[model samples]
Target chain A: MRKIGFSVIYFVLVSVIFILNYTFEHTAMVSYSFWNITRAVLLIFAVIVFPLLNRRIYSIAVTVLKEELRKKTLYVIFIFVALLVSLIHVFGKIAPANQHVFVGEMGLSGITLFGLLFGVFMSSTAMYKEMEKKTVYVLLSYPVSRQEIVMGKFIGNMISILLFSFLLSLIFVVSLLVRFGPINSVIVYSCFALMLEFVVIVAIATTTSTMLSSTSNIVFVIIIFLLGHMTEKITHIASRLEAQRLKEAAEVFVRVLPDFKRFEFKDALSLGTVIEPSVIIASLSYALFYSAVALIIGMLIFRRREVDRL
Target chain B: MDHVIEIKGLRKVYRDFWYRPKVIAIDRLDMEVKKGEIFGFLGPNGSGKTTALKLMLGLIFPTSGKIRILGKVPTDVRIKEQIGYMPEESYLYGFLNADETLDFYGKLNGIPRARRKERIEKVLDIVGLKHARKRRLSDYSKGMSRRISLAQVLLKDPDLVLLDEPTIGLDPVVSREVKDVILGLKSEGKTVVLSSHLLSEVQTVCDKIAILCEGKLIKEGNVDELLTVNGETEIVASGLKQEDISRIKDVISSSGGKFISSGHPKETLEGLFIKSIKEKQESKSN
Candidate 1:
């Protein structure tokens, strides 16, 4: 009954947002984008898939989720995003002709920025906090294996990040609706792609966190995030160089870094370009494969790492 | 014949970042704890009591030597189901309330929901924290946190329990209660390995003890055997006058025995504190 009550409250909150969007549509025509539809579908899929995990893994994930919820970081981010969306009128006044596009871009950018920041920060600190607080001692003393702990933290943090993405997407969607009747397909795809990118970033953060201090982990994750985003550009510039050795070195660097461009559909979204379904599928698959490899590496390192430092 | 814990030449050397040996926390030490015994591990700070406990729990890797718990390698995950460990410090998640903390650990041990709930209540009641189970650990006093830690240890009713300094930082009354709980566990035929620097506490409850100094086992034997004086004896007689005590001493001297000393027996501060508190509680109830 408590769960039902919470669900009803959530439903009512969403309905209120929808009603607000409808009311605002009279002043400015609302438009729906393909990206918006894709995000809604993806979120629904995540909601269904997360619960199917093993009980032990699911319990760990829920613990991590509860920890994050209690920290109130998610609420703070949501409130910040809410305030940012409400102030989108400033952007609209700046560019009247492309007001809706600008609004969508700002919303997507805000979600992407906040999502990446939270993902990297949370992932890097999750294991470190456990160790420093010696909470991991109690956890590791159980029958649970190291792999389960790593995987649990990853999945738990991933779900929290996804929920964050979903909330930001809703705020963006509402902002778009207020400015323009319906959101474009590009906006939805952009947000989805951003979420995929966050998955990869979180995996990197979790892996680094196994071996590095929290501060170092954050620095390393940020460096990777920047390098990942620049992989294509760096390779492109490298190919244009005269020296073959330098080009080869750049190629290795690019291959070593995560190709964040694969999921970076924001530029295309801003240009109002239609994203291919194959590209979306390929991007999602790449994110999953990369995330799996990163988590596996983290588990391997964590299994051998001595947790008796305290 | 039946050893619940066996360590053969176990050595743990912590290394620095450059792979240089930094400290030898545990030397080539060996010991065995028999089943159903409250075996006390006595050592001072930095004497490797904690290091040894961590090795036994497989929390750290041994630089050399071997440890077996329940006839399996220490690292065996399956063995942990039958083992419970309460560290020297009450290292609990501060955010979780006592109930949530127990529930979380119960889940980690893979206890079924119904059984876990039952055990949580039982353990909380045993630790006298049933009423304060909803209070966050951060809000708990040090003694309360230690009680919760002990409750979590017993939540699964493990066969082999390792308690490191269980009475450390606790009041005499609470400490006596913890000792009684250990005795209770012993009564149930559970094998307990307790480590503490409190000789008095260890003396009262430990059936056998191993004392370590500078990472070496300096002494090992039954508490009574190790503490018994070969040529002297202690006599306690209440309601005896000073003349009666003098007469008893003269009789000992006449029996070809040297009279060492004779005086009123002194009660340990812990014992006195416990008695006072118990009396106060009884009077309050009455």
Candidate 2:
């Protein structure tokens, strides 16, 4: 929760810079380029707030590393996030001229990819490792609720991931400022959008991990991510299917799947567009709604779990 | 006086993909431990001893039973503050040294800094791990890590302590030291529930014994009463001949005593090692 609070604070730093830039630039309207800054803000906002909405990720991590501070696995994950962010930045640099996207938009995407993957990996293994090693039995004996134990693990892991994400984003931002002379408002908005999207994905991963094995949970979360982005297409195919009943089922699936397309504020960033305040507010609401639902489901599953195994 | 723990008809059924019928891990178990007593739970593998302990600790809920620890439900956060536990397996963070781990747990229980420091040092001394306090948990051997975990439970000076297989991996000397620690806790009027498979370990330290088998209670009573009632009557003859063994059994039977076995009495390895360590300690104290 601290990490989430801090991340939210860190995200607004870019917005502050944008407000200052707008004061000097004499912009008549919050220009198309302002979308970039909004997106950046959203990305950070989502990462911080998402953990609170669905605690499984944060709780699992906390449980794993709370007592021991020296597990090199945490440091290794840091290195992995750093390398992933750098690799994404490199890929963004080599894109074709026609595909020239803003660096802020590119950076947000990198955060979502790396952050979500790391979230799932940590969440899935948190309780599984404790049970396998019989370490969980110690905590179970305490009068502490399973919720506290699960929440502790998720919070602990979230802090680590937040550290990694923040460090990587900080470096990316620094590089952007050095190359582009103080990233415009366009980058901030782009980052914000990415943060919001990653939160939803993190929640999905966390919720699945309570019931599924580590590897299976990761696979399940990845599939959800993939399908989340194609709900519209699914709806389209459902309309065209030969069987009417099948099409009806597909429609229901579309409604239930997270509308990953709605999270796409990148199109606005590409044109350097200013996102309306309403859109930002709406996107946040969606992220929060998804997070709440996912967490409720995760909690229900966890409530019934046999503590002996974990 | 508040009973530290009370359970009525505790039962646990584990359902997994691998098993056809759900595993009845615990069945209709009823027991209680008073405010301050060294209570031992004894059972063999698959006997539901660990299951019963887990239920009492409220690590997992009983399928159809009720348990109260310290006058509250097992899952009550308030009760957790007053309870300390050492599991059969160490669940410590491998990154922190012994001292750091203790500090983390102590703080969680809201122990103030200065007192936490004193407690850390004191508990490490009790567990005989003061020398290894600086070593990271990952660097410690199995026995060392277990000792650190034991130290962690005691650091909070909890009102109730639940220890499951607390001495499984320790050396004989260390195990004896742990026995002494348990005795010390008993003297302080702290309730201590220890679960172990070694009958002798319980026989030496436990005031009361609860024996479980196949998820059912086979017997439970004070050590003195149970031993007097169920223990085999023995006769020692210094100059008995081989043919006299049969006669000895008949004579014992006629005397209303059941003769179970005859053998040369020898000190067990663990017993000898513990005796030697105790002699050294006594000499040092003198």
Candidate 3:
């Protein structure tokens, strides 16, 4: 962690000097402080995506995903994420919304999308590919527990996402500092919260994939992500219908489903308001709770899996 | 002698998706494979040979009964250090080259780098894959992939080796090479439990044999003992004429010998192929 933190700080310092030099050469009219502010804003956006970009796993579950995604077949996904980030930069010319977007938000959103795509690939292929290809047998024959394999895979995946977000976040921050004002810290925290939401979604998707087909798992997770934000509204609608049983069931479902809206730090980003520490802690705790449950369920299903058939 | 594997009333029933027919993958199957002997497990397709292997490896849990491998429970992590397994299919990470793949498995087995390099070289040579060292597994043919899997088993140098159809799709030449590798493993004082449908291959390699069908152990014993246990005899007599051959069955029956099958003097296809190749080499030497 110290090494990672140092690298991030070093990258920011280097970007600040380079961006300042470029700003003076191109726009001699702009003041030094203005250039400094622009670099700071950009760095803030970069921070959003930074967590995903680093090449290491913070935990064990993410470590397995990191290893799996390291396979050359999955390199294309990383390229696609980089491409999307560059395209988002291009879009800044057309819409002012692009300018208001935090580098972190853009990056976290891009990584979330990439992570989901990778999650689909991970969840669908995790057991099925191993079983079909007979790799599961070799893996199972090892002294490692089945739960460890599942945990390792999940960790590897999460870590790959982190690596992507981290590196891409740095790239994004450097780009931002070159163009806009300095990045604010509030946006950084919000983006981190958003990425955690993505992790929660991935965990659920992974659990679903252990039992369902690839196509079905993707569809199911997407629906969960979509409807997850509307839990409060869904509950309200159930109450308006005046059907007590339906309302009760809807309330129950809403609690069971992740309230992704809570992790959407977009409101705080747009308003430029600092999020309360309690809010951040609460959201993080919720994500952890969901992720832990989903992982446990996935392991249970995987333990019963026969390697002979996918 | 210590038994490397012990089984009692082992059963596995799949209940999910399909109707609950209680398909017995291993039905009260009881057997023991002693240490330091090559035990051949033979059964036709869908006869639960593979299932029994899976259960023993703890890849899947048995619905009932228990299995012990290397004096520990099959799934016990401690026993994993003592057992190596080569599955029927060439299931490997296609992205990694042979060297990287071996390194990864070696790491999983807790082998250090210096010793791992020495062991990797030895096993790669054993599997005859020293030349194609840098090629990614995706580029490998089915035979090469199988050889790499075999190399992984050898790298561990475990006390017990379980091979499922070790030479299923290999050409005659490669198959013989693989057979020799298995034979070499036995000479190292390692116990091997292998499953194959090839009766002749089992006959040549195994000291003890177990025949399974429909998830049940039908027969098992020393190869020679089982053959003679039912008083069935096979004779290879070369000097008999046509009329003498006809009378030979009666002579044997009258002499209290039970004839299993009678045939002309002809070697097995595998035997003839091996013999002809050897003869050509001997003739060249002369």
Candidate 4:
């Protein structure tokens, strides 16, 4: 608890400094404070927070990672993805403006595809499979709470997603550097945005999975993902409609559903939107806050659920 | 003596899609099990014995009632730290070895690494799975799988243990070993609550028993007191048996009573159970 309290305090302190830096973009002191805050947050996470995470959650996370790691197919999947990207690079030679742009676009797409797959599939099955196999009976019989189980599984899936993203990102970036000689700095932001997007995707899947089966959960979350991308359009339609009832309903949905357009790093880049610091902060905070809410809701539902029924 | 478990007016009614009462899995029932006693939970299929155990573990919510285990509500995770539960089926993760499974459970209980290792060895030894500790559960025989499950349950050295059909599918040797383990737990001052359909097994280990019928407690008492026949007597004779038997017959004739045939000195629990049920039905019809 002390560890968590310390971490939260440090995080808020750093985030305040970071926002202040953005607000006073021209101030030398604020920029220096921003650098120090960034470094301190990274160091705190690596040195203090990682080791201080709840032991039960960490153990569960490791078990999940080990289970997926032992499957031995992740390597094949990565290789398969890299080969597809290489093929894309080959197609780039048919002569558009520059091959690097095409390669970067295709590479980022591959990362997003794999990361989403990792997040969605693992979240759906992590807890469901434990219950299906009745392995949960023993685990639940221990001193662990339903919240810890849900959080542990969520963290497990997140770690798995992180590793998959990193490996694929490496493959994409390495392939780009070798083939195109230079790469854009915008790709870093794109990867970060993709990861944040997955955080929401995985949390939504985790939340729905408590009540739904694996297949239904996957189907439901896929529909949610699709609808999330179209929330902007839905909001516009809600405003310009004559039917007050439907408009109210659409407005409710727009308020409830996550506006995925917030994480549209690629769109912002392509349109030369300058990627303001406040925009980046807003997207980051939205993704985190949304994921946290989804997880809490999942825990509450799972807390009330009967494991025997599961 | 403190009651290790106290359940009052416990009812669990599983609902349907429309939020209507569907099946009353456990009707209003009350039970108390004391510390250091092997409490047997006996019932036929679908009689709510398993449902009762699940309720004690807080795996399911009771419709209306209270359950306190180890002086705390079942849902409290602190009570779980002191309770060990083993379900009927020992189906665990097929991908894990016995050590890995026990280690995972130990970590869940927040046991330190060094103590967990020591406790793991002790439990593996108890379940007689020390030799197969490194073997993956998927490759284990049914008995081995069950033993490993038992080992996991004992990993935390819990104060109260709940076993649902602990020896259902095992051979006689293994079943006997499990019964012995239950007895050993009693010897160690730990409370054991076991649910089983095997009357003979329950009769052997249980000091007190509860007979549940269709989600209601039909009978509950000390095993010896419940099984003892009220108006029956038996005498064992050794030398001059024929002469003694003839004299007993003559005495019986003089007393205007017929002697009942007897082979073994003690009546089987199975026979008592059937007789009890028949008398119950006859009384209900009357």
Candidate chain B TM-scores, in order:
0.94, 0.83, 0.85, 0.87
Model 4 spans with C-alpha error above 4 angstroms: A1-52, A72-75, A268-282, B236-258, B262-286
| Tens-digit lDDT track of model 2 for B246-273 | 8877988999987777888888889888
lDDT of 1 at B15: 93
Q: What is the per-residue lDDT of model 4 for residues B1-286, given as tens digits with 9 covering 90 to 100?
A: 3999999999999988798988998998999999999999999999999999999988888899999989988878777888998889886777778889888889888899999999998988888998988888889999998898888778878889999999999876678788888998999999999999999899999999999989999999999999999887667765656677788878987998778873446676545665776788899999
lDDT of 1 by residue, A1-310 (tens): 2223222332343344345435644445444343334434543333224332446567788888877878776688778976786566578777787776787777777887788779988999877777887777777678776666777888889888988888777777776777677778877787888898998888888887888889988998998998898987898899999999998999998987899989777677657788876677657756765675576678778878888663
Model 4 Cα lDDT, one tens digit per residue, A160-276: 787777777777777777877766766666777777788788878888888888998888887888788899888887899999999999999887787777766676445544565
Q: Quick one: ranking by DockQ, best first?
A: 4, 1, 2, 3
lDDT of 3 by residue, A54-134 (tens): 222122244354357557656787777777765566666555664656455676578667766766666555655556667
| Two-chain complex of model 4, DockQ on C-alpha atoms against the true structure | 0.49
Could you give the interface RMSD of candidate 2 in angstroms?
4.9
State each candidate's clash count.
20, 48, 44, 0
Docking class of 1: acceptable
The better candidate by lDDT, 1 or 3, is: 1
Runs with alpha carbons beyond 4 Å of true place in candidate 3: A1-77, A87-90, A93-98, A101-111, A184-186, A238-248, A276-286, B16-19, B228-268, B271-286
* lDDT of model 2 at position A105: 60
- Compared with the true structure, model 4 gives a TM-score of 0.86
The prediction achieving the highest DockQ against the true structure is: 4
Docking model 3 quality class: acceptable
Per lDDT, the best of the predicted structures is 1
TM-score of chain A of 1: 0.80
Task: Give the Å shift of residue A128 in candidate 1.
Answer: 1.4
Ranking by lDDT: 1, 4, 3, 2
| lDDT, residue A219, candidate 4 | 84
